[model samples]
Structures are given as C-alpha cells and as structure tokens.
Target: MSPAKSRHLNPKKLIRSKWTSASPRNKEKHFIVTNIIQPESKDLPIDLIELEAVYSGRSFALSWRELTNTQDWLQGWR
Candidate 1:
C-alpha cells in the first residue's frame, strides 16, 4: 500500500478533552481568545476597471483583467 493510503487507515479522534477539564466560562474565554488570534480576510472592494484580450484564430477565447491590490491575483484557486 502507498504511504498516503496507509495514513488514511489510522483511526481519528475529534473529542475536545480540554473542554471537559476547563470550566464553562473558561471555554468561552478560550473561544474568544482564539477568535481574536485567528487571521481574518478583509473584504475589500475591487474595481474591474479595464479588460483587454487578443485572439488570433479561435472558436472562443476568454481573458479577464481586474483591479485588485492583493499580492496573489488568482483568488478562486485559493
């Protein structure tokens, strides 16, 4: 068997054991702290101001251009 397939055979446990150990209030505080620390993506308006494409000989060719300041352009791939 392949290494990747063998890894999937292992049983997985998803219990939050620490939650039972901690008090109810402590769990809430933990969640709040974790949420604050978690990185969030800011939804910024993008202006698709200009789009230019060239097609020599094809049935259908589609190209797109948008105005965005994001470091990585391909948002859908992510």
Candidate 2:
C-alpha cells in the first residue's frame, strides 16, 4: 500500500478551521477548531488545540500536528 497523503497545516492559522475525520466515531465526523492552547512560556510554540464536534457539541484537546495526518483527518468537511 502507498503511504497516506498528509495535509499541509499552518499552526498559526488553525483557529476556526474545519475538518472531517477519516474514521469517525459516534457520528462525530465534522469538527471545528474552537481554541488554540496558549503556551505557558512565551518562547514555547503552540502544540495543542481544542476541537468541537458539530454533531454533539463535544469539545476536546488534541495535538495540532495530528491534523496533518490525512489518514485520520481531512482538511475540510467531507
């Protein structure tokens, strides 16, 4: 099998972005970037973000880099 195609993501522009899970569970396929977790130290880069499910209004924190893995996530609603 070929390698999964990954999406190019810019962490600075992730807020309010839309996404679709490749393998959705509990019918929570659509999601939006609700918030970007601020780093405790100014020198630290952004590493986490909050994703809110459109179907269930559930929110959770996740590594921003995980969105780059197209095998698990798509850039927009699909």
Candidate 3:
C-alpha cells in the first residue's frame, strides 16, 4: 500500500522533528530539523527551513513546503 500523505505542518513546531529523504545521496538519507530560521524583520515571513543530515552532520536550508512533498521526503526516520 502507498504511504499516507504528509501533513499540513506548522514550521514553528518543526524544531527537532525527524525526516528521511525519499532518495539517498552519498548514502545519506536521514535528516532532522535543526532550526527554523527566524524572520529577520517583523514585516518578513519565515520561508526557509534548516535541516541537518543525520549521517554527515551537514546542515542546509530549504523551503519548508518541500517537506510536504511525499515524492521527495518522508515524515519520519524510515
């Protein structure tokens, strides 16, 4: 059976949440939310999400909406 749809999430609550990439790169598939980049100005909105690779200790930022795409990301460690 196909996996369930990823949830409509709140970025503010995603700190420390785990994620798994649908496709592995350099055998690194596991990741975790390390930080939710704070909006620099009150007039701005948060748009970037930070994740750390559990395998390599490398961190990167991406659009938070990308997490909702099941084709590229899974909701938990898998």
Any idea what lDDT model 2 has?
0.94
Predicted candidate 3 versus true structure: per-residue lDDT over 1-78, tens digit per residue: 787477698988889999999998987899999999988897887788899999999999988989988989998999
lDDT of each: 0.18, 0.94, 0.89
Candidate 3: count of backbone clashes, pairs at least 3 residues apart or interchain: 0
TM-score between model 1 and native: 0.13
Q: Sort the candidates on lDDT, descending order.
A: 2, 3, 1
Count of clashing pairs, candidate 2: 0
For model 2 the local lDDT of residue 17 reads 97
Per-residue C-alpha lDDT of model 2 across residues 1-78, encoded as one tens digit per residue: 898887778888999999999999999999999999999998999999999999999999999999988899998899
TM per prediction: 0.13, 0.93, 0.87
Q: Of 1 and 3, which scores higher on TM-score?
A: 3
Segments in model 3 whose C-alpha atoms lie over 4 Å from true places: 1-6
Worst 10 residues of 1 by lDDT: 29-38
Q: List the residue pairs that clash in candidate 3.
A: none
